[model samples]
Structure formats: C-alpha cells, structure tokens
Target: MEQLNLLFEGFQHALTPMNLLWVLLGAILGTAVGVLPGLGSSMAVALLLPITFSLDPTAAFIMFAGVYYGGLFGDSTSGILLNTPGNSSAIASTFEGHRMARNGLAAKALATAAMGAFIGGLLATTVVVFFAPTLVKLATAFGPAEYFALAVFAFLAISSVVSESIVKGLMSLGVGLALAMVGVDGPSGTVRYTLDIPQLFDGMSIVVITVGLLALGEVLHIASRIHRDPAAERVKPNGRPRLRKHDIKKAWPAWLRGTAFGLPFGIIPAGGSEVPTFLAYGTEKRLAKRRGDIEFGQIGSIRGVAAPEAAANATAGTAMGALLALGLPTSATAAIMLAAFQQYGMQPGPLLFERSGDMVWALLASLFIGLVILLILNMQFAVLWAKLLMVPRHYLYAGITVFSVLGVYAISSSTLDLWVLLGIALIGFVMRRYDLPLAPVLIAVILGPLAETELRRALTVSEGDVTTLVSSPTTIILYGILLAALLFSGAKHLHRRARQRTGDSEGDKELIDA
Candidate 1:
C-alpha cells in the first residue's frame, strides 16, 4: 500500500509537461541512434552525459530512461531491415528477423520485435517496481568479497559463453584489463601504462574507447571489404504492420520464455543482454524442433524474432533495476549511468531509496511512461526507420566516421584522444577480423578496477588470508556458478570439435578409397 501511494505520487511528478518533453526528446534521439548501425544506447548515453550536466537530476534521468527504452525498440528495426545490428544485443534478432526481411515479411518481423520488446520490458519493469526493496535488501548483504566474486563470475561467463573459442574470449578480456590499467592506480597514485604521457594519467576515455571499438572500428572494417562484399538489398516494409495469427500464436510463449532467461541475469554480473538474448535464441531453436511447426535457422521464424528481442529488452529493464537497487552495473550502458549518478554526488544502493526517495520513485514512474511512449512510436514508425537503408553505403559510412570523430573530440577537445581513438579503432578492426568478441573487452574495462579494488579491500579486511575471500556463503555460491559455467562451456566446445573431426575423418576415408 505504501509503495503504491508513493508510486502514484511519482506519476504526478513524472507527468509534468517539462519532464514529458525531455522524455520525448530522448526517445526521438535514441531511436535515431538505434536506426544507425554501430551506434548503441551505451555510446549514445555516454556522449550525451556531458551535455546533461546543467540539467536537473530528475529531468536528466527521465530523458535517459526514455533513450534506453527507445534504443531497444529501434535496434530491432535496423536488424530486420538491413541485416545489420545496431549493437551486440540485437545480433540474435538479426538471425531470423533479417531472414524474414529477405523473404519480404519485413513488416511482420518488425511488429513481432516491437511487441516482444514491449511485453518483456513492461513485465520486467513491473517486477522492478514491486521487488526493488527486496532486491535492495539482498544487495545490502553483499560485502567486498562478495562483489569480487560476482565480478569474477561475470568475467568467466562472458569470456566462456560469448565467443566460439574460450581462448579468444580470454584474450579479449586481457585486452580490456590492459586498457583499464592505463590510468593512475587508485590505491597508489602511480600510473602503470601511461608511458609518462599527461593524458594517460586521467586514463583512456570510455567515450573514446567505445566509439573507437564499435563505431570507428565498424566503419574501417566495412571500408576494407566494401568492394568484396555484395551490396545489401534494401528491404522495404510490406503489408499492414501486424503479425499474422500464426506468428502471433508462435511469439507469445517465446517472449515469456525469453523474459525468464533474461530477468535473473540482470541481478547477477552477467555482461548484459547479449548473453540472455543468445540463450533465448538457442532455447527457441531447440523448442521449435519438438513443435515442428515453427521453423528455425535457415528459414525465417517469428519465434526467432520474438524471443531474443524480448530477452534483450527484458535484460535492459532488469539491468536498470539492479543498478538502482544494488549500485551494480552489469552492462556498458549501466556503467555510464552509474558514472552519471556519481557525477551528481549520488550513490545507488539500499540507502538510495531512503535518501533520494522522490527521485527514485519518479524515475521508476518515468520508465513506465517511456515504455508506453516508445511502444507506440515503434509500432507506428518501424517502417520509417527502415528507410535509413535508402542512403548510399559510402555516404552512410562516411557520416558515421565523421560522427565518431566529432563525439570523441567533443569530450575534451584533445588531439591526443583522437589518436587514442584511431589506435583503438585499429585494434577493434583486427579483433573483428579474427572473430574475437568485443563485449568482453568492454566488460573487462568497466569491471576491472572495481574487481581489483574489492579484492584489495577483502584482503585487507581478512589480514591477508586468501581463505577469507570464500568465507561467505555468497562468495562460495558465486564461485561455484563460475566453475559450472566453465565446465559447461568447455564440454560444449569439445563436443563440437569431436563432431567436426568425425566428419573430416569419414570424408578423408571416402576420398582415399575412391
């Protein structure tokens, strides 16, 4: 009853004209970013953060909430039409969504993605509203050792699960940790990787690194193969923007299942939507085989479009809740938001709800509003976003390159950051060429310092005893999960290799005999 009353109060404030306008602007800007390939919510939020310094905290967060939701809605648009995902989270959507587009069912695919995202996001937000205090209680119980363990779990899960080869994943993680070490050490004021450069003391800018890896890197990679790769066929949205009865029937269950896969990981330190989205895609494929009616893989399946889209959106919602209640950030976007909170002289945790009750409640209210607004916009304008493909490829990529350079320079007007951006862009291009996962790199950069500081704090508290790290039940359970993830991924990899070898040996025997 008390929570309900406070929620009502929050709605009163959130519905104000000024706050609503900010939300609308954010939604529009985020949608534009999502429609453009290589731009994501994380980069959008980071680039926009510096501009929001003068805005009220409530207004700033309200705008950001809308952007977050809108970006998810828009990501599926490009994924379906262009076969180009706006971010890693949308990769699963592109599998079947793009297939549907190629088959001239672009409208249906877009509608399924929009509806699935809406349902997942709305349900997850409901969970956050009712269960936030409960989550806060759980978060308050965590100690330094527990946080360190959670970070380790994230590092292992992302490294092992995201990439086809665990070795490549671990290598990507090493790169991130190496970059994270560039700045002045927190405990000792000594810079490790700066090479005595003044700009190195402040550390590599997150904006520079993200823009370099995602935006600039993509641009350069495409430029290298522009002539080799065939031109993409522009997929025009067709028919009414509504799913067929059969597709509707196939999608709801997948959406629910996907939400189930995504919600829990938001609370854990998992690397964000990519993990749950891929998991949802895999689960849907297996279930489709048993059902036999819904096809997957080579053919376009509405469930394929629905489930992963839902999972990704659901992860976004729960991720926000976890950030608010736990002071924990599981994804790059959440990490930037955490930095925003810190800039405002605020800390998110159990005390946040008590100390900044009005802001928290109002922010929650804005999420609900943002969901409704974005759903309407996506349902109506998905085709409009698809029209982005009308632009020439050369012009499109050129614009993206210019935008990346501008956003990085805007951060500090420093020429040195531009050089760093080019360097990281080269690294990103190489990694992409080698099929190395980029999410682990971003996760490592964000969590490395936190993990290091927590480990140090735990050791200090334990009087240098290593056993103290696992003394807590929470720490033990987290590590146990990490071990399970490693074994499961390892076994899966080995099974795949065994199948490949069997196929090769059999082929070799036949050729020799012939």
Candidate 2:
C-alpha cells in the first residue's frame, strides 16, 4: 500500500507538462539515435549524461528512462527492415524480422515489434514498482556456478537456429568462441590470442563484430549474388506501416511469455537481454511446430518478431529497477547509467530510495509514460521509415556500409577495428553462402567469456573439483532444463526425417502404379 501511495505521488510529478515534454523529446531523439547501426541505449544515455546536468534530478532521470525504452523501439525497427541491429540485444529480432520484411510484411513486423516491446516494458516495470526488493534478492542469489549453468543454458537455447544443419551451426559457434578467446585471460594475467597487438588486449568489441557480421556482411553477400539475381533489391513495405488489431491479438501471448523471460535476466548479470530474447525465440519456434505453423523459415513467423522484442524491453525494465534498487548493472547501458549516478553524486543501493525517494518514484513513473510516447513516436512515422527502401539497391547498400563503418570507428576510433570488420564480413559471407546459422555465432560471442570466467571461479573455489559445478540446486535445475531441451530437439528431428521418408515412399508407390 505504501508503495502504491509513493507510485501515485510519482505520477503526480511525472505528469506535469514540463516533465511530459521532456519525455516526448527524449523518446523522439532516442528513436532517431537507435535507427543508426551499432548505436543503442547505452550510447543514447551516455550522450545525454553530460548535457542534461542542468535539469533537476527527477526531470533528468525521467528523460533518461524515456530514452532507454525508446531506443528499444528504434533498434527493432531498423533490425527488422534493414537487418542492421543497433545493439546486440536487438540481434535476435533480426533473425526473423528482416525475413518478414523480405516477404513484404515489413508493416506487420514493425507493428509486432512496437506493440510487443510496449507490453513487455509495461508489465515488467509494473512488477518492479511493486517487488523491486524481492526481485533484487533473487537475482543476487546467483553465484559463479549458477551463472556458468545459465551460460550453458544460453548455448543450448540457440538450438532453434541450429535446426537447419547441425554441422554448420556448430562451426558458426566455434568461430565465435575463437573470437571470444582473443583477449587477455583474467585469472592468470596471461594474454592468449592478442598476437602482440596492444588494442587486442581488451578483446574484440561486440559492437564491431555484430555490425560487421550482420550489416556489412549482408552488403557483401548481396553484391556477390546481384549478377545472378538481377532483381535483387531492397524490400519495399507493402502499405502504411500501422499496427493492426489482428497482429496485436496474435502477439499478446508471446509478449507475455517474453516478459517472463526478460524479467529475471534483468536483475541477473547474465549478459543483458541477449539470452532471454534467444530463449524466447527458441520457445516460440517449438510452440509453432505444435500449432502446425509453417511461416518459420520460409516467410518469418510473427511470433519470432514479437517474442524477442518483448524480451528485450522487459529486460530493460528490470535492469533499470535493479540499478536503482540494488546497484547492480545488468547491461552495458545500465553500467553507464550507474556511472551517471556517481557523476550526479548519487549512490544506488538499499539506501537509494530513502535518500532520493521522490526522484526514484518519478523516474519509474516516467518509464511507464515513456512506453506510450515511444509507441506513438515510432508508429506515427512508420510510413516515412518504410520509404527508406525507395533508394536504388546499390546506393542503398553502399550507404548502409558507410554508416556502419563510421559508427563502428566512432566507438574507439581504431583503424584496426575497420580491418577486422572487413575480415568478419568476409567470414559472414562465407557462412551465408554455405547455409550456416548466424545466431549461434552471436550467442557464443556474447556469453563465451562469462561461461569461461564463471567456470574457472567455481572450480577454483572448490579446489579444482569438477563436481562443484553441479552441486548447487540452480546448477541442477539448469542442467535438467538443458537435457529436456536436447531430448525435445532430437525427437523433432527424428520425426521430421520419418515424415520425409514416408512421403518419399508414397511417391514411389504412385510411380509404380503409373
């Protein structure tokens, strides 16, 4: 009841016309920033942290929260339409989202992403408002062993994309793991794969790898095939990209399920929204088979776009909650926000609410308001965004490459990164040509280090005993879940092969009768 009262007071502050204007401005700017490749909410917030010091703490936090949610919306838009994920969290959406656009469902994909993000953020934020402390405690319960198990879970969960071909999928995962090993090892203070380069000591940035492998790689692959496929061109959105009632109805359940995946990961240091979004995508694919949905690989299922978007934003909500309530940063953006808190002479933890109760509640309330504003900010301009495909194919891809290279270089202003990007882009082209999956590569790059570090920590604490990994209840549960997922995948594969054989035999019988 007291929380509810404080929430109402929060609304009182957030609803003021001045504060509302700030939310609107932040939402608009955030969406614009997110449309750029490799720039996400972390960049958006970092850029704002310095300039917004003039505003009072409540108003400043309100705007920042608005920008955070708004970035998710814009990130999805570009990921779906252009196959350019603005952030790693947006990567899962591109798996099906860009395919949906290629099938001339850009409007539907856009609507699904927007609505799903809104539902996820709204429910997740509401939960945080009421149970921030409890959620924080649960997230903090995860130790090194639990986090290692969670990393293993993420590796297996990506089997959704792995279903195309086991050999090729594993190959993609191996490449990611190799790239992840390039940095210096933390425990032994030894460099493994830096190759005597100073810049490589810190490791390959996810931003550069993702932008290169997805956006620039797509450009090169298409260029290589443009001669054979003379009609290769950007997909044009079929109609005004407005949200439809049917799309919302089909997506609400996915939104809810994705929210469930996102909420827990938000409070845990398990590599941000990437795992939940991938897990949500995998679960929806499995459910689609049960429902006999055929839109998956050929024409992109709406569930694919919906579930990942929801998970991403839901994680965003809980990340903000955990940051304010427990001082734990679950994402790169949240870590930057933690730094911003320090810059503002604020410390976030158990005593945060007591010291800055008014600002805290107001920031939470503004997050709710920000969701609505972002939906409008993105949806109203849908037609204009769709028109981006009107440019010529060659010019369009060239522009994308230019923007991507520039954005990547801006990260650390390194020429080495540009060269590495070209190399990764070539590798990506090869993988695409050979029918290898890209999602597993991304999943490994994101979680490989976490898995390595956690496993080492757990084993060292147990004095090199291998059993230390599975001794905990959380580890037991995680491994149990992984086993179940593998069993289900094997059954599905066998069933598919049997169905093909049966069809082939029937065709042979018909040929004999003829």
Candidate 3:
C-alpha cells in the first residue's frame, strides 16, 4: 500500500505535460538510433549526454531512462528484418526472428517482439516498485568490506564467466582498469598515470572515453566492413499483425516462462540479459511439442521468438532497479546510464533515495510510459524500420563515424581526447575481431575505483584483517554465489563437450560399419 502511494506520487511528477513530451522525444530518438546499424543505446546515451547539461537533473534522467528502454525495444526490429542485431542483447532474437521473416511472417515477428517487450517491462517495473526500497535498505547496511567483496564478485562474474575465454576476458578487464587509473589517485592525492599533461591531470572523462570507444570505435569498425555484400532481403509486412488465437495460445506460456527465467538474474550482477535469454530459448526448445505442428528450428517456433524477447526486456527492467538501488550496472546500456547520473551530480545508491526521491520516482514512472510508446511504435512502424536496411552500408557507417567523432569533440574540445578516442577504437576493434566481450571491460572500468576505495577503507577499519571482509552475511552469501557460478559454468561446458565427443564417436563407428 505504501509502495503504491509512492508510485502515485512519482506519477504525479512524471505525468506533467513537459515531462511527457520529453519521454516521447527520447523514445522516438532512441528507436531511430536502434534501427541504425552500429548505433546502440550506449552510444546514443553517450552522444546525448552533453546536450543534457543544460536541462534540469530530473528531466535529463527521465529522458535518458526513456532512451535506454526504447533502444532495447527497437533493436529487435532491426534484428528480425535485416539479420543485423542493433545491440548484443538482440542477437538471440535474430536466430528465430529472421527465420520467421524469411517465411513471410515478418509482421508476426514484429508483433511478438513488441508485445513481449511490453509484458516484460510492465511486470518488471511492478517488481521494482515493490522491491526497490527493500533492496536499498539492505544495501545501506553494507560496510566497506562488504562493498569491496561485492565489487570483486561483479568483476569476476562479468569478465570471466560471461566471456568465452577467461584469458581474453581478463585482458579486457586489465585494459579498463588501466584506463580507470589514468585519473589522479583519490586516496594518495597524487597523479599515477597522467604523464603531466593538463587534460591527463583531470583524467579521462567517462563521457569522452565512452563516446570515443563505443560510438566512434563502433563506427570505425563498421566502416572497415562496408565493402562486404549485405545479406538478407528487406522484408515488408504483408498485413496487420493481429495475433491469431493459436498464436496467442502459444506465445503467452512462453512469455510467462521467459519472465520467470529473467526476473531472478536481473538482481544478480551477471553481465546482462544474454544468459537468461539463452536459457529461456533453450528451455522452450526442449519442452516444445515433439511430433507436431512445428519443430524448434523449422517454421519458426513462436516460443523461440517470444521467450527470448520477454527475457531480454525483463532483464533490462530488473537491471535498472539494481542500478538505481545498488549502484551496479549489469549491461553496457546500464553503464552509460550510470555515467549520465554522474554527469547530473547524482550518485545512485541508498543515499539517492533519501536525497533525490522525486527524480528516482519520476524516472521509474517514465519507464512505464516509454513501454507503452514503444509497443505502439513498434507494432505500427515496424515495416518502416525494416526499410532502413536498404541504406547503403558505406554511407551508414560513414555517417556514424562522423557523428561519433563530432559528439566526442563536442563534449570536450580537446585534441588529447581525440587521441584517446583513436587508441580505444583500435582496442575495441581488436576485441571485436577476437570475439571478446566488451561489456565486462565497461563494467570493470565503472567499478574499479569503487572497489579500490572500499578495499582500502575496509583494511583501514579492520587493521588489515582480510577475514573481516566476509563478516557480513550478505557479503559471505555473495561470495558463495560467485563461487557457485564459476563451478556451474565450468561443469556445464565440460559436460556439453563430453556429450559432443560421444555423439561424434558413435557417428564415426556407424560410418565405418556402412
């Protein structure tokens, strides 16, 4: 009841005519960027961060939050129609969604994506309304030791577990940590890696680095591949995507299951929605009808598309809760939003609730509004978004590169920032080529300073007793969860390899017999 009152108060703040207009504008702009190849929520938010400097903090954050969710909802349209995933989270949707499009079911695919996103976002926001305060209360009790331990858990879980190769993942973390060190040492009040340059003294701005690396780096990478031939035909919807009775029957169960799979992981510090989406897809494939209407990979299982879409959006919502209440970002988009909060001179954590309650509530309210707007836009304009695939790749990537460089330079008219941008672009290109995950690097960069500060404070309080770090029950549980994740992931990989080898051996024997 009390939570409901708070939400009503939040709606009062966010439902104003001016705030609603910003919400609509953010959604439209975010969807436009999401439809464009190589442009994602992180880049979109980073590029727009400078523009928000002149706005009130609440309005700025509301707009930023709208962009974040709007981008997630819009990316699937590109993935389904063009086989070009606008963001990493949309990759799974491409698997089944593109297949459906090829079968002349583009309208169905778009409708499912839009409706699934709506369901996931609505439910997840409700969860946030009920649970955010409790999570903040729990986080408030965390001592420095507990906080340090939590940070360690985030670093390990995101980098090592999420990436295919632990070595490459660690390397990414190393690079981000190195970047974080470029600024002056907060503890010792001495410069460590600035090299005496004036801009180096202030260290690399998060805005400058993020825009340069993600936006500009992505543009450069895309430009390098512009000569390659584009695949997939531009799909146009044949008719309105009204769900048939059968389609609804098949999709609703998947939506519920996917939501169940995603909601739990949102609070955890896993890399992003990828894990849950994959798990949902896998589960649906196994439980699907065997002898029947359609197979897993055949005519396109509605469950395949619906499940992952719901999970992806649900993960996005839960992730927002965790970020606002706990100061943790589970994905790249969330990391960029964190940077936006910092730009507004607001830190997200327990204290944020006490100090900036109105802004927080308004942000949450805008999320609901954004969801409705996304659903309407996606269902009505999906065919139009699909037409974007026809744009020449060279021109698209070229424009991206130009805009990215301009956005970065606009943030800080510094030659040194351009140099830093070029350096990070090379690094990002290499990571992409090697198939190393970039989310972990961003996560590490965001959390590295916090970890360092908390560890030092814990040591100071405990007289250097490392055991004191796990004294709190929450910290101990978090560590245990981290350990379990490592073991479970390792065991699953080994088991999968063993099964593959066994199947291959049996096939070989049969071939020899034949």
Candidate 4:
C-alpha cells in the first residue's frame, strides 16, 4: 500500500504536460527505430544520449524509458512481418510469428506480441516499484568484494550461457574487457592502452562502440548478403486481429506460463531474455498435448510468441532495476542507458535514490504509462508497421550505416573516432560471421573497469588479505552461485555432445550393417 502511494506520487510527477510529451515523442521515435532492422533500443538510446544533456533529468529519463519499452513493442512487428528480428529477444518470435503471417494470421501474431509485452511490462514494473527500495537498501550494504563478485557473476552468466559456444563467448568478453582498458588506470592514474592518442585519453565513447557494433556492424553484415534474392514477403493483415475462443484459451495459459518464466529470470543475473524465452518455448513444447488438433509449430502456438515477448519486456523492466540500484546493466540497451545517465553526470547507485528519488520514481511511473501506450499503438498500427517490410533492404541498411557513422562523428567531431568505428565494425562483422553473441562483449566492455576498480578497492581495504574477498556472507554466496552456474553449464554441454556422438555412432553401425 505504501509502495502504491509512492507510485501514485510518481505518476503525479510523470504526468506533467511536458513530461508526457517527451514520453510520446520517445515512443514514436523508439518505434520508428525498432521497425528498422539492426537499429535497436541500444542504438536509439545512444543516439539520443547527447541530445538529452539539455533536458531535465526526470524528463530525459522518462523519454529514455519510453524508448526502451517502445522498442520492445515495435521490434516484434518486424519479426512477425518481415522475418527480421529487430532485437535479439524477438528472435524466437520470428519462428512462429512469421509462420503465422504466412498463414494469414499476421494480425493475431502482432496482437499477441504486443499484448504479452504489455502484461509483462506492467507486472515487471509493479515488481520494480515494490522491490526496488528494498533491493537498493540491500545493495547499499554490499561491500566492494560483494560488488566485484556480482560483476563476475554477470559476466560469466551472460557470456557463457547466452552464446552458442563458450569459447566464442569468452573471446567476445575478452575483446570487450580489452576495450574497457583503453583509458587511464583509475587507482594508479597511469595510462594503460592510450597509445599516446589524445582521443584515447578520454577512452572510447560508449556511443561510438554501441553505434559501431550494433548499427554499423549490422548494416555491413546486411550489405554482405544484399545480393541474395529476398524471400517471398508475408501478406499483411487488412483488419483487426480476432482471437477465437480456442485461441484465447490456448494463449492465456501460455501468457501465465511465460510471465512465470520471465519474472524470476528478470530479477536474476541470467543473460537478458534469451534463456527465459528458450526455456519457456521448450517447456511449452513439452507440456503441450501429446495428440492435438493443432501441431506445435503449425497454426502458430500462442505460447511460442507469448513466452518470448513476455520474457523480453519483463527482462527489460528488471534490467532497469539492476541498473538503477546496483549500477549494473544486464543488456545492451541498459548499458547505453547507463552511459546516458553518466553523460548527464548522474551515477545510478544508492546515492542516486537519495539524491534523485523523485526522478527515479517518475521514471518508474512512466514505465506503467508507456506500457499502456505501447499496447494501444501496437494493436492499432500493426498492419501499418507490417508494411515497412516493403522497404528495399539496400536502402534500409545503407541509411543505417550512414546514420551510425554520422551519429558517432557528431558526438566528438573526431576523424579518429571514425577510424575506431571502422575497426570495431570489422571486429563485429567477424564475430557475427562466426555466430558469436555480442551481448557478452558489450557486458564486458561496460563492466570490466568497474570490476577491476572494485577488486582493487576491496584488496586495498583488506591490506592484501585474500580471505577478505569472501569475508561477507553475500560475497561467499555470490561466488558459490557463480561456481554452480559454470559447472552446470559445462556439464550440460558435455552431456549434449555425448548424446550427439552416441547418435552418430548408432547411425554408423546401421550403415555398416546395411
């Protein structure tokens, strides 16, 4: 009840005419960017970071929250209609969503995605409102060792579990950690990797790295395959999406299950929405009727789209919790938002709650409003958004690349930054080509310096006593969890490989017998 009253107060602050306008503007812009393949919320937020410098902090953050949730809503349109997932979280949605579109159920797919996201967003925001204060209090009690351990847990969980291969994931993390080392050492105040370049003194801008990898790298990757013939486009819906009674029955359970899957993972440090979505999808497949009128993939199981969409938006909301209280970013979009906060001379930690309480509450309030706005816009305009698929691939990617380069250059007016963009672009291109996950790299880049700084601080405070690193119960528990995750992941991979080999051997024996 107290939390509800505080949230109402936050609404009072967020519902001001100017703040509402910013929220609407952010939603519009976020939707536009999200509809464009390769330009996700991270890139959108990064581009808008500098522009927010002149605005009130509350208004700027409200706009950013709009962009974040708006992108999640908009990305599904592309995934369902164009078979191009605007955000990685929407990847699973593409499987059943595009299939549904091809079967002339495009409207249904879009509706479900939008509504599921709303439900997820609303629930997650509620979670944030009730839990954020308590979490902030607990986080404030954390020592440097606990914080360092938390960083390690984030790094390992995200890098190891999210990617297809652990080696590639670790390599991406290594690259990001290396990039994070470019600036002068904080404790020693000595240059580490500046190479005497003046631009290096300030370190590589988050805007540069984000735009380079996500936007430009994605553009270049698309360009490499532009010559291939496009797939037959899915038909767009001409009327409102109607859910049959049976469809509703099926979808409701999926919605509940998906929300169940999402809420826990959102609060935990698992890698964004990917794991939850996959888990939900797999669970739905297993729990589905053994003999059903509708096949799992055929006719588009509502669970397929609902689970991932819910997980995606839920993760986004909880990610905000992590960022605001713990100074951690669980996803790329969150990282960019963190950079935006820093750009505005605000550090989002315990002190932030004390100093910027109203702003924080207002941001949370805007999320609830944003979810409602998203639901209306998505349901009403899904067909129109589907029409975006008609855009020529070449033109879309070309414009993105141009904008990416322009956005980066505009930040600092440095030709050297352009060079760095190209270099990172090449690196990103290779990583994508090899099927490596980019999230780990971004996570490492953002968290590496902080991890290092905190570790050193902990050690200094303990006068080099190694036991001090785990003196606290929280630190010990966090490290234990990290260890368990590593072992579990390793065991799973080995078992999967063994199963594959066993099947291969059986096939060979059959061939020999024949």
lDDT of each: 0.79, 0.86, 0.73, 0.74
Highest-TM-score candidate: 2
Tens digits of per-residue lDDT for model 1, 305-396: 88988898888888899988888897888899999999999999878989998988898899888988888888787566545545577786
Q: Pick the candidate with the highest lDDT.
A: 2
Per-residue lDDT of 1-514 in model 2, one digit per residue for the tens? 9999999999999999999998988888788888888787678777767767898878888888788887778788778877888889999888888888877777778878888898899989998999887897798689999999999888866844445555676788889899999889988889988889999999999998998899988998989988888765656676656656776677888888998999898999989999999999988877887798888766998889889999999999999899989898889989988997887899988899999999999998999999998887667676677667667788878889998899899899999999999988998999898888888889999999999999999999999998989998999999998888778777777888899999999999999999
RMSD of 3: 7.0
Identify the superior model by TM-score, candidate 1 or candidate 4.
1
Error of 2 at 419 (Å): 0.6
lDDT of 3: 0.73
Off by over 4 Å in 3: 1-121, 128-133, 202-367, 492-514
Q: Rank the candidates by TM-score, best first.
A: 2, 1, 4, 3
Question: Clashes in each model (backbone N, CA, C under 3 Å)?
Answer: 0, 0, 0, 0
Return the TM-score for each candidate structure. Answer: 0.76, 0.96, 0.63, 0.68
Total clashes in model 4, counting residue pairs 3 or more apart in sequence or in different chains = 0
lDDT of 3 by residue, 1-514 (tens): 9778877888899898888888888888887777654455666676667877888988887787678877877677766765555665676676678668656677788888888888987888888889876644543576787767767876776665546566677888888788888877888788878878878877776545554555556556656664562442233444556678988898999988888877755766544776567567656654663335464566577778898889988988888898988888877888888888887788887788889998898899889988987788778886665444345555644565665566556556888887887888788777767777665666566667878888888888899998888888888898998898778657766876899999999999999999
Ranking, lDDT, top scorer first:
2, 1, 4, 3
Clashes by residue pair, model 3: none
The CA lDDT at 237 in model 4 is 51
RMSD per candidate (Å) reads 5.1, 1.7, 7.0, 6.6
Off by over 4 Å in 2: 160-162, 498-514
Candidate 1 colliding pairs: none
C-alpha-based local distance difference test score of model 2:
0.86
Report the Cα lDDT for residue 374, model 1: 85
